[model samples]
Target chain A: MAYLELNNVHKTYIEGEEEILSNINLSIEEGEFVAIVGFTGSGKTTLVNLINGLLEPTRGEVLFKGEPVKGTSHERGVIFQNYSLLPWLTVEQNVLMAVKEAFPKKSKKELTEMVAEYVEMVSLSHAINKRPKELSGGMRQRVAVARALAMKPEMIIMDEPLGALDALTRGNLQDEILNIWGKDKRTALLITNDVDEGIYMADRIIPLRPGPRATLGPEFKIDIERPRDKTEMNDNENYKQTRNAIIEYLMDIGNERKSEAQEELVLPDLAPKDFVNQFK
Target chain B: MKQSVSLNTAGKIARFNIFRFLFQGSIAKVKQMDPKVALKKVAISIASILLFLGLWHMGAKALYNKEADFKINKALEERGQAAADSEAACIASGNPDCQPNTLPSPAQVWASFNSLLKDHGIISADKAAFKEKTAALNAQREAENLDPIVYTGRPSFVDQIWRSLGTVFAGFLLAFFIAVPLGIFIGLSPNLKSAFNWFIQVFKPVSPVVWYLLVFMIVKTVLIGSPDDSSFTISFVSVGLCSMWATLVNTAMGVSSVDNDYINVAKVLKLGTFQKIFKVILPSSLPLIFTGLKITLSVGWMVLIAIELLAQSPGLGTFVWEEFQNGANDSNAKIIVAMFVIGIIGFLLDRIMLAIQNSVSFVKTDAI
Candidate 1:
């Protein structure tokens, strides 16, 4: 049986309205890293929320480990895009809250050590006592990552976690996340808009065609070896072909949608008013 | 020995650091402030206050002269020129009976303030003496399970101020306890909020006097057989009910408007209902809650005087009422003194609440 599966999932916020997601089907085997790349506002977040059990599918079934998903559980840890660290709590406290909740049987000392370890892993040990307001955007996102990872969930779900960070910070965090995921080889789902980010981190990349009834497209398999170096990938054959193919496909669909939306306006055969002639 | 000495020195340094930390923020702020701007602000405030006092003095003098003239003219009309002259002479002589019983001048109010302080001192001495005199009798009364002989003297102005403070604090506590939990419950669901909306709106604007009467009716009957006084209870409860509406409304709004992101985080963490409220909802809404509390406290203080007067509680309200009824030579000045005390206390209460709010809230907020 697949580790996590979504079968014919359909969702709409309002009853009898245009569906935000329709006829969605996905299945991830254990220890598989899957990335879903899509444009902004393409219902990517709604898809992530459904898989994580934050939202229920309006139509179909989402099964996890051979059982149907019910509500949210700590097993599917989500690193939210907006760095939803509780503003009132310090970084350590924020991580500690999640760790304690996920591992209720763990001792306080154990939880504290786990929080410290994850914070250090994200290179934010110095900011352990700082509140979210006191941290930079990149630092806040790092804290969110630490909070999600410290719970030691079976799956790591990221929703464009580095979207708000600058290029340099984003690069550093991508490697850090890759390193962490490689250590455990946990089942991971990364929802992002960056095509290169999907190719680098995900074993298989899929595009979510743009919505109001968005569905998944054909998958691209990345047969590249583990620990893929960014610089060397430029000279590699598979990387060039994959990057070109994904970009071209995205552009083609994007242009197709644009043309479909642009209906040529036809004006009626009309002339200027004859008021001047009438007055003369 | 070296380690022990270092530890001792470290402890001493830590003690000094405590004081340093307490004042460091304000000292830094002052140091960072531009000297010229700070001076200008101080100068403006002083000038405005002086101008207010000058206007007040002029108004008082004009009213005094008008009353004096009217009195002399009435004497002349009733009697003759000699009587008018005598009346003018009496007014010029600065007799207490001939003084205008109108708004007291700032100087008169200041004098009244000092006189009240002096009266408090005398009353303290008298109470001490009374305590000494009744010590043995009180012991016997205690043994016999009888009420001891108490001081029959009136409460001093300071005592009345303390009484008012106590009542207002009690009222504030009542308001907080009643409003916060009820607000949270109402805030959690839209249906509850809608159900309670009309009820809150109706009661919010009801006058303090009416609230006092309502409370009095209920409390009087409930405490009919009890030995303890119910007036204090009625007064505080009335003030609480009268002032709690702002807090209730603000709290509901705060809770309902918590950021969706935080709520999602709570859900993702699988937080229980109470856990979600405490860990996510309360912290996110704390800024608004504090804003509500600040309004509630100020409103409670504003209505307390009226409630206390109606309840006949021994507070500044009753003192003002009594001084007005007394109509003695210094009665008007004493009343004015009470007015200033009430205003100053209300201002201080707001500042204190603001300080507390600033400390507790994650975000900065302002209150006046």
Candidate 2:
């Protein structure tokens, strides 16, 4: 059975209103690295939230380990784009808090060591005592990544975690996260607007169309070999086809949305006399 | 043999650094440190205070007129007596209390402060004597299985300060207990937020005096059969109710406005409801809630004086009111001293709250 599955999932915040997501069906196998690419408001967050059990689906089910996903669990760790580190806690304390909660049975010394280890992994040991306000934007996101990885959850979710970082930092953390994931082979789901990032990081890529009724688009498989080099990928044949195809597909959706908006103008109902008077 | 530096030397080094930062390094640091701005800030503040005092001296000297002699001479002239009779004659004849009411000069206020301290010392001595006398009687009463005699001595100036502080604290603590939990509950539930919002708006604007009277009526009725006069309870309860509105509003706002991202993080962590509150909800919203609490504490302090005056409680408010009614030669100056003391104490109270607020928040509390 797939490690995670979303079966015909539908969600609308308001009852009987337009749906944010409709008929989303996905199955991610164990240890699979999957990335969902979409526009900014394409219900990607809603989808991730549903899978994390932060929000309930309006219809259908999100299954985890072949069981229906209930409420939130420690098994699914989330790294947010905005670096949602608690503004009041030092970087070390922020990671320590999550570790403490996730593994309450660990001794204090063990917990401290684990926290230090993960923080060191993210190369934030120098800033272990600094609060969120004191850290640079890149450092804050790194701390968040450290916080999630430290939990050692069954699955890791990244909601455009590097979306806010500068190009250099984003490239660096992306590699760092990829390195960490490679070591553990943990099931991972990455949500990003960056198509190249998805193709580079994931074994499979799925596109989510823009909403008021967003649905999953056709999947693209990256049969590229493991340990792929980003710089070398530019000259690679498969990379060119996949990147061009995804961009072409997204552009088509954008145009589709635009024309659909143009076609959706409603004509007001009027009596014959009122309709004739409109000309005058 | 060469030895590595020990923890003790490390500790000393740290302490020396802080000391340097304050003394010599501070000036150098001011040339280089933040809070480095500290020395210049303090210097300017002291200068401003001196300037203020100088202005006050000038204003007071100009405002106070020697009207007593003029009034007395006019009265004498009306009665066809020698209006040239020296005003000094009245004083030389043992009438020393001849000063007219005016805003006291800073020097006069300083003199009154010293005199009030002396009076407080005398009152303290009296209280000690009373306690000693009652101690023996109290021991005898305990031997006889009777209640001990209570000391009913009047509260001194210092005692009034302590009383006011105690009353304000009691009110603030009570308000915290009532408002914060209610606020969290209301914050978490939209239905409750809407339900209780109207009540909060209405009661928040009600004056402390009205609250005091309302509490007095209720407490008075309850204590009719009971011998313990409940002025303490009345004053505190009124102060709490009067000040609670700010805390409640602030707490609810803080709680409700917590980042949706953090809330989602809490859920993803699989935290229980209790864990969600203590870990995620309380900590995240603490800054705003503290902003509310600071307002609550200050409001409570501001209202306690009026509440004390109305309730006949022994506090600084009553002290000021009593001095106003005394109509003595130095009463105005004494009142001025009380005014300065109240202002200083209010400032201290706010600093105490700020210290606490800073300790809890990850964000360093910045000054206004």
Candidate 3:
């Protein structure tokens, strides 16, 4: 059995009168890095939330390690796009808070050591004592990463965590995350709108089609080596082929949705009238 | 000896180099300093004070001159005639009749001040006499087995000042005690917020005077069951209720305004309610909370004085009232001085609170 399984997951958000997600199904194995790629408002966040037990699926089951997922727990740590580190707490404190909660019985010394280790892992030991406001966007996200990793969850879910960061900072954090994920190969899932980011970071990239009811479209296996360099991967033939394939698929979905919208707007009775009476 | 001499020579050279470096650095720093900015600040301050004093002197001269064009001169003349009449009455009755309605000139008020300070020791003597009278009164009541009226001895300017300050502080403290915790609870819970919000909105708009009257009557009829309640408890309660509304509203808003991201962080970390409130919510909301408190305290002072005036409580407001009623000419000058004193004290209090707020503000993380 897959380590994490979703059985015909369905999420419906009532916006005036519209159902959001019909039936979404996916299976992720332990030590597998999976990225969900979708356009904006493709129910990507809802899917990630369901996977992390932040939001329950309306008509489906999310099984984590053979048990159905319930409400939020420290067992699955999530890194949000906003880098939700407590502004009042120093970076070290933010990390330590999670560590302490995850392992309540651990000694202060042990928790302190764990916090330090993670801070070092993120290469933010220098900024550990700084509050979120004092740090730059990248540093804050690094702190958030440190905080999530400190918990040592069974799986780490990221919801476009680097979307707010600049390109240079995003690339740096991506490598740092990849390095961290490389160590223990823990179950990881990333929800991203960036197609290249998904291909480069995840073992499998799943494209989500947008709609009044959105669902998984196609899974693309990223047949690339581990610790892949961005430049090197871009030059690789397989990488280029996969990137083009995903983009082509997404563009096709976009075009289909656009034409569907046009069809909906079309009024058959409003077509051009015959001008036979004009000559008379 | 030769080695020691060589070492001394090296030390002297090092010291000379250090002195030269220090002198050069000082000269550079001084040269770079903005003397123009300093001079401008000084010039502005001097100009402001000069303008203030100029206005005051002109107003004083106009009042004294009694010119037909100056409307205040007519008022001053009327005041002087009233003072003369009161003085004649006092001489006839062998009692001082200085009061607000019959304001004396600065010269007359200054003379009276000197006489009171040097000859009769009126301020201090009156205070002592009043204290003694209260003590005697309390003793008599104790002996007679009557309800003891706490006679706050005869009021001096200082005594009145202290009494007013005491009431203001006591009322402010009471208000803070009630409002801060309640505000926090309301801020944190949406249900409580909704429940109590209407009540707060209703009460908040009601004026302090209304609160004072309501509380005064309640205390008079309900709590003490007597019109002669001497504890000033009613005054304090009235001030507290009136001032507490602002603090409560502001604090709740402040707490609610705390960044939602902090709350999310707390949730993800699984921090307990207590930890989250104390560590995150309280610190973030502190600037606003302190600002609210500062405003509440100043308003409390104003409300306390008004309450004292209405309640006939022994404070500065009552003193002002009694001086007004006594019909003494010099009393107006005293009132003016008291007004200035109140303003200065209020300004200082705000500055003090601001300093405390800045001290407790969130520490910059980069300082680490």
Candidate 4:
């Protein structure tokens, strides 16, 4: 069985009347890193929300470790895009809160050691005493990463975790996250709008097409080796081909949407015979 | 001996270099120090005071001098009739041209205040006894067909201040006991928010006096059922209801305004309901809660005075009203003193709240 299975998942958010996600089927292995890439309005967040049990799917089930997902639990830790560390808590406290909640039976000394160990792993030991407001945007996100890792869940779901950082900061944190994942391989899924980020960090890149009723369009496997170097991978033949394929697929979907919109404007006033003639 | 001499020579060289550095640093630092800021501040303060005094003296001279002229003209005519009396003889013989009988200077008021303290029994008697006697006399005057007497006795300022402070604290605590938890519950649940929102909206804008009147009537008709009920019942109820509104509104706003992201985080963490409220909800809502308490306290003070005025309660407010009705020549002086006392007490109350706020408030730095 796949380590984490999402079977024919469907989500609909009727803000009056609109379907957000129609059908999404994905099977991720135990150590595979999957990235769902899509436009801003696409159902990437909704899909991740379903997997994390933050939002329930209108249809289908999410199976983890051969069991159906029920509700939000410490088993699946999430790193949100806004770096939702409590602004009132210190960096150390933020991480410690998660650790404490995840392991209520642990001794205070043990929890302190656990928090310190993970904070050190993220190279944020120096900023442990600082509050979230005292840290920069990048530092706050690093604290959030430390917090998620401290929980030591079976899986970690990231929703555009690096979307708010600068390019250099994002690249640095991307490497840091990969190094952490390498230490202990866990099933992971990332939702992002960046194609390059999807290719570099994920084992498989899944593109979600945007629409009134959207669904997963295609899946591209990133068969790159572990500890992948971006500079070296740029020269690899397979990396270029895989990246081009995903981009082309996304661009084709964009063109299809554009033409559909154009047809709406022009075809409304046309006769049925004229519309058929124009299509020919 | 030879080794010691070599060590001494090295130490001397090090000491010389340190002294040289200190001398150079002191000279540079001294040169950079500027006295201009201090000088400018002092100059501005002096100029402002001088201008104020100049304007004041001009007004006094113009208005008081004219009144002084009329008084002196009357005194000269009365001097001929009182020449036979010894007190009038002394007044007639003195330099009548120099002394102004219209407006007293700061110096004259100070002298008069001292004399009143010493001779008029204003500041020399037992304060508690004096307050009791004054109250009794006022009550008697109201009972009989007679005008009330001026309070010639002075109560201890410190004692009066403590009494007023104790009342404010008691009333505020009572208000909080009723307001905070209700506000939190109303803020958290939409059903409660909707149900009570209309009442809060209507009652929040009503004046404190209106609430005080309602409280008074309720106490009179329902609780006491006596025309001669003690003033405490009316005062306590008035202050409590009037001051409780701000805390209710503020607490509700604070709880409802908690970031939804925090709630999601709590849910994801699988925190229990108690844990969520105690750890996440309460801490996040502290700033607004403290702000509400501060505002409620100040409004309570204003309402307290208004209640005292209407209910004939024995407080600073009653003291001021009684002084105003005395119709005595020195009634203005008593009113001024009471105003000063009220202002000082209000300022100290706000400062106390501010100190409490600063101690418990969460401090967020700019780096995040």
What tens-digit string does per-residue lDDT give for candidate 1 at A1-280? 8999999999999999999999999999999999999999999999999989989999999999988889888899999999999988999999999998898999999999999999999999998999999999999999998999888889999999988888899999899999999998899999999999999889999999999999998889988998989899888999899989888888988998888877666678775679657766
Interface RMSD of 1: 0.6
Query: Candidate 2 overall Cα lDDT vs. reference?
Result: 0.87
Per-residue lDDT of candidate 3, residues B1-368 (tens digit): 99999999999999986555434533454467798966776799899978876677667766544432243334447777676555445444634442223334455555655643453356576656776878878798899999776434455666677888888888888999999999999988899999999999999878878998788677776765455565488788888889888789888988888887676667667778898888789988887788689888888887766788887878878877777777565666666656666777777566555555555676411110
Kindly report which residue pairs in candidate 2 clash with one another: A88-B362, B29-B32, B29-B33, B33-B36
Alpha-carbon error at A253 in model 2, in Å? 2.9
Residue B253 accuracy (lDDT) in model 4: 94
- Rate residue B210 of model 4 by lDDT: 92
For residues A204-225, write the lDDT of model 4, one tens digit per residue.
9999998567889779999999
List candidate 1 stretches off by more than 4 Å: A264-280, B1-28, B366-368
Off by over 4 Å in 4: A263-280, B1-154, B220-229, B363-368
Model 2: per-residue Cα lDDT at residue A268: 84
Q: What share of the true interface contacts does candidate 1 keep?
A: 0.97
Kindly indicate the candidate among 1 and 4 with the higher lDDT: 1
TM-score for predicted model 1 compared with the true structure: 0.92
Q: Candidate 2, TM-score vs. the true structure? A: 0.85
TM-score-better candidate, 1 vs 4: 1
lDDT of 3: 0.80
lDDT measured at residue A170 in model 2 versus the true structure, 0 to 100: 82
Compared with the true structure, what per-residue lDDT tens digits does model 2 show for residues A197-229?
999899999999999899999999998988989
Model 1: per-residue Cα lDDT over B1-368, one tens digit each: 99999999999999887545444544566588899977887799899999999999999888888888999999999999999999999889989878767788889989989999999999999999999999999999999999999998988889889999999999999999999999988999999998998998888889888899899999899889999988899999888888888889989989999999999999888888989999899888888888888889989988888888888998999998888999998898898888878888887677677667667778865542
User: Is 2 or 4 the stronger prediction by DockQ?
Assistant: 4
lDDT of 3 by residue, A79-157 (tens): 9889987766789888888898899999999999999999999998888788889899999889889889889888999
Off by over 4 Å in 2: A104-117, A125-129, A258-280, B1-47, B66-77, B80-95, B129-142, B146-153
